[model samples]
Target: MKDSLLWDLSDIATNETFPQLIADTKKRIDKIVTWRKHLSPQMEKKQFVKMLNEIEDLKSVIACIYDYPALKELTDRTDIKAREMKATALDIVIAAEESVRFIDHWLQGKDVVGPEKLNDEQAEVLFSIVPEHKHLLWRSRELALHTLSDVEERIILQKDLQLSEPLLDLRRIIESEQQYKIKLDGEKKTKVIRTQAELSKLTTDANPKNRESAYRVLFKEYEKNLDKYFIIYQAIAKDWSSVANLRGYNEPISMRNRANDLPDELIDLLYSVCSENLGIFHNFFELKANLLKIPKLRRFDLYAPLKDSDKTKYSFAEALDLVIDTFEGFDKDFADKAKRVVAEGHIDSHPSPKKAPGAFCATIHPKITPYVFLNFTGKTRDVFTLAHELGHAVHSLYSSVNPYSGQNPTLPLAETASTFAELLLFDRMMQLVDTETQQKLLMERLADSYATIMRQINFSMFEKEAFALFAKGTNPEDVSSRYYQNLLAHFGDSVDVDQIFSYEWAYIPHFVNSPFYVYAYAFGELLALSLFAMYKDSGEVAVNKLKKILTFGRTAYPIEMLQELDISLQDRDFWMHGFSVINNWQKNVQNIFSHERI
Candidate 1:
């Protein structure tokens, strides 16, 4: 399995097909519900413990049933069966919301015996068996304050799921149906630029004309279906707002921040720091434009390569070796865990027309190894992506000792390993490349940094504006206009903003799927940059600190976890320090250019 690049779902369920698996899951869910019905808050301590075990088992089964179909649909968006199965499974899981609420309610009740009440010996025994379960218990109690009544919760769950289906379907429609015909190198080519992954590569095409054509075509498709996409966006935004309001959240983003166990103030600080440092990226864009021999960068040329016809490419096998070796250099355990992902056939790394664009690492349950999905195109960036997603896999593996609920870090911390992996890969490339190629790599790294950090920060800004406008019942055109203005601010005068690119916001799935989620990338990249700086300064000690943080999973709050390394999320200066690192890289690029001019 380690030798294979494709994911083998057999480990999840081999005897049954997907349909059979769904049926089996339903039966198991019913049994759990039936068992749950027999229990009450008045139950004995022994019975309470038994119920806790039952809930854990139920969570594991639910995760197992949900993940395979979801992964299937993501791997091939055109698979109707996979989509249907995933939708059905999600509906079942939503229907079982009562069970979850019921357990949480019971756990929160005064009649339930808690760990503090137990004798020290008894507490020790429980801790030995489920050391992390105490955190889950505590979390449940915290959520209990926010939990709606079972009936109300079910209605909201159903409504959210129902609203989500169309968005998912719309995503499939866009990915599978969108096409753009353009002329390149005196040849007319028809490209099905559906996925962001494909459009991302196309945006960096060596030819400026090709890059412009790709951006125009990409946005034009969204513009063509503007009304439909707008309605979808409106529905999703309204639904999210209504839910957040009902949950007593101050705003839509507040709900997301709470879910990630982060303070709204911390995110605010992040955005504020980034917004203040926009000049750094503006300088980068201007430098890039100068390097490209253009007076000003068009939005399309934002990702344009500094050099024409860059020959850097890596085969999938070669990419695997490069990422594995990079990880090994950083930490042997990191490399070994990354290799296990490929070895266990937990990666889907083929390029196909219908395959979903982008890459992700999905960890279904702590007991099951994580799976990675990639649209590997053999590009040098693809190698970094390979490392990024595999970094997520390794993070999951490290936290496998946790229960399913405790295994995953919050969204910001979740990117810690993935972004760290990219940094390691960048350093490795620097060490191995000639001076000319090294400069190219540095330019590419700068571009990536801007993309991941400032770009995401700008997206967060757009979301804030868009959501505010949505609350006012702003029209789609008005929303698009606002988005265009956001882009103008993001690029400043360093790049030319096209009208068509205003329609660009219409295609960003995160705005529809996960509102206010973009900031996590900004949060993560900066955090990783800081952590990498620590690694450079402190070496193995920093590495050990990171390993400890990853292993803690959700047991500790992310802010508290970082404090172990003397990093403070609330410190504006700390975030500003990350920008300083970027500024240093910008200086390095300028130095290289000046030396070349000589």
Candidate 2:
């Protein structure tokens, strides 16, 4: 039977079918090309505005048209039609971008400058007409050194689609479609699981043996296919490094840093602070081990539930109510925006065969109420994931006032609302539990923090080294050895790191799909934690501050926007504030244990 919580996709289709949409997209691209041919650097302000508007319209149309097929593929990877349609949609987007490439190249030329930086002659030109596009123009000028000619850029995009993209698709297919088998306690027969999401839940199973079995099953599968995984990853890394080199980026991660509009110093500081604070998590692991009444923790036991942990299985409906009510407690608008996702049938709320692992909220355009994908399994973490994805939906809705170009925040700030929502949910969950369960909840929150903040940083650090090694033509075994060393460094002596855990990196999709994307989690969590502290102290004022930050979207530099709220990203102290919160929680767990012993 289809679950009641299953999302309704009837609203996804429009009057035009996929074929018609593709045809319309082609016509749109051709129109843009014709429009571009008629453009001139010496054009009037009105003409410039018209050209910008046309490009913006094309972008919006592409986003709206591509969302359905892309979403369908995530829901069911086996749907060959969806896959084809998505590729077609992507190709059309690339074609449209290729056609309009000259606009940016022209803007980056001497004829155009930022509003503040414009000369008398430049002021007379069309670029000074739109103040809103000043940042876009200024940014182009700043990156003019790396901005290739339209032809070169086109070649790179085409090569990425033809070469790098297929490798990514192959990795996804292999990782997502593989089946995992494990025998549970008291079961003579083995069980087969289709999706990694199903298998992952067992990693936190209350039973220690079940957790061990789950890890063994997961790593064994990856170990068997290590060579293929290595080839795919190595190729992707090489491609990424080559492109970075071609673009004159100092390092592979510098490309991502530039795209995120953050400085290399800032990222280096973030990573340095995180690496220095490794002992915090090491202490946390020891605390967790003591709580579990074990001598030491295995990597598999990192998320293991405590003996007295709340094992209450929440229904989907129940989880939805908890999340909604939690949001409502903070602000009615936030709650309503989150509820809109559910009301519009935008949430796919259950796990199924071939469904993608993990949860995400897809914002197609400002007008669309983002669709959320989930593999809910009634665990407490599942409830938090519900809140997390809904939080992303609310953030998108809040930023709807922005043009398509400015609607999405850069990767680091993107997690602010989502992580803050988890904080709200965590606080509410605390209120509903007894003191003992509250301690358990605190422990779980710590585990989540370790996963969200430290683990992601670890991934980012590994990527930095892995990318460098691959560029030097490092072997797969050496790469795996490097990854294992990273694991050992991350866990230290507080937890046991096994050989099979080296295969764990292959299981991470972000490394394949978007390199260096994991660090954003750490950045967002730390930022959100600091903001949440302000909320606890100032209440409605802090809420309004967050709402304002969400609305800023990509309108200003993230650092400037944050500075407007008295949040500074310039120093190590700001990052330390977040770790301090985690440290206090660890101390509280110790206090709870101390009190019990007396």
Candidate 3:
């Protein structure tokens, strides 16, 4: 089936208009709050079950209400109506959070005086009435252990909704408003570049001058507003630290680790393993520098193509077909689900002015089809991105059998399918290309691995240090210098670490929007590498195991879910094994170059 180029949002609210949907959502919120306010420990099983059902319905309605505006805004950041709708939706949802907290507290039996555990029959009946509540119960109990009083929790929630969230939106608005006018070859007039998606295309331009100019213009524009970005980062960091301290977390990252159900030690181990194996990427960079015949690789040269080989742009249809075929080769079901994302009008596949720069799959609710937003430029990486986002959509579809609460996985496991999809696409490309093209493809694949794994890990390292510096009241300039040092550590002597690149951190939305979130990319990429190896060795059996894992969603802890596939996150050697895969690729590239020299 042919995929639609643009996503259809009408299906999300077919019967009602945006204002009507907002009003309906408010009614559901009222209903939920009323139920929660009347909740008591002495309530009967029937009453509890009724409340759970209402919560489930409320979740579905709220998800649609929030998601519609979110998707609309992302598709066109310039849309005033979309932005207003998003703010309205966020207001309603933030209010609903109070009710949610109450329910969770009650689920933890916090209000009960010497509450007794439910018998098996009673438990079974409760699960039967609201199967999703089974997952919610565990999460609620886990959160209850770390939760503060309702009053304190509300304060934090209010600060987040009123302060932190608005700051993030302001940063995005500022970024979207930036326009870099640069002269292009064969064009008499300077092209106005607004989105990062456009700037990205120029980063890989065949001309070194073009590449350098693009980098400078992009960074220069951001430099002009560096103070604002820094202030935003500072406020976010302080807010995060304040909340973390209040919650008794040792560090801001520790709070995130707890949220992901990941042990601090496991994350430490992963970071250490990746740090030790930085040499593999260093070697890749040295090789790239040699290929470019430069003394050292510049920041702009980082994404420079090894060869101008086959700049053939794939149309949206062709990209979709390629992605579907790659997934089909692995499993027809995977491909079918990916196709359904398009067929169901769930994918926005074109780039436009004021649209979000990157791609993402938003799984709003378990019952609702996931929506994917993409700024497709027809680059090969764009194809991989399409596959990646579609992989996320498929993952949501796989977990759709679960309740709304259980439909989304932890952040680390959330990236598993998306990165795995990229790997699958890489493998498919390797098979289709000629020997010379295979070498180029291999280099491209390794470049991606370095970007996704090492680059992200380096970003996390900067966050680790930046957080500490922020606590010490360090200025953004000092923090930028520290980030430069982090880049130096990653690149080592293989590449030139320009001073200007220090300002690059100011543009990273993750640091401000989601603190310490970059590490999940490294974690997911490494884990996906290990999982991809398992797929190659065990084939269909491993594929089936992966499908089962995706179906888990947030039902089980991430580590426990992986253990089902005989994968141990705590095993130090398991992470090193992912490095070994990269090392082998490095060796293959070395051998390819050696053969060419002869």
lDDT of each: 0.78, 0.83, 0.82
Give residue 401's error in model 1 in angstroms: 1.3
- The number of residue pairs in model 3 that clash at the backbone is 0
TM-score of each: 0.87, 0.88, 0.88
TM-score of candidate 3 to 2 decimals: 0.88
Lowest-lDDT window of 10 residues in candidate 1?
110-119
Candidate 3, residues 452-540, lDDT tens digits: the string is: 88889888888888889989888868988898888887888888877889899998889998898889888988988888887888899
In terms of lDDT, the best-performing candidate is 2
lDDT of 3: 0.82
Off by over 4 Å in 3: 1-4, 15-20, 73-84, 111-132, 166-202, 213-229, 352-357
Every model: Cα RMSD to truth: 4.3, 3.9, 3.7
Give the per-residue lDDT digits (tens) of candidate 2, residues 1-598: 2334666655655435767767877887887777655555466667778878878878877886678877787878898887777777777877887777766666666332222233335634554677666666677777877777666787897898799989988988888767899999878999998877789899989999999999999989988888889899988888888888898999989999989989888999999989998898898888878878889998878888777667879888888888899999999999999988888888898888888777998887777778899999998889999999999999999988887787889999999899999999998987888888888788888888888889999999999988888877787688889999999988889999888888887888898889998898899999898888778878999999899999877777888888998878886787887888788888887788778841
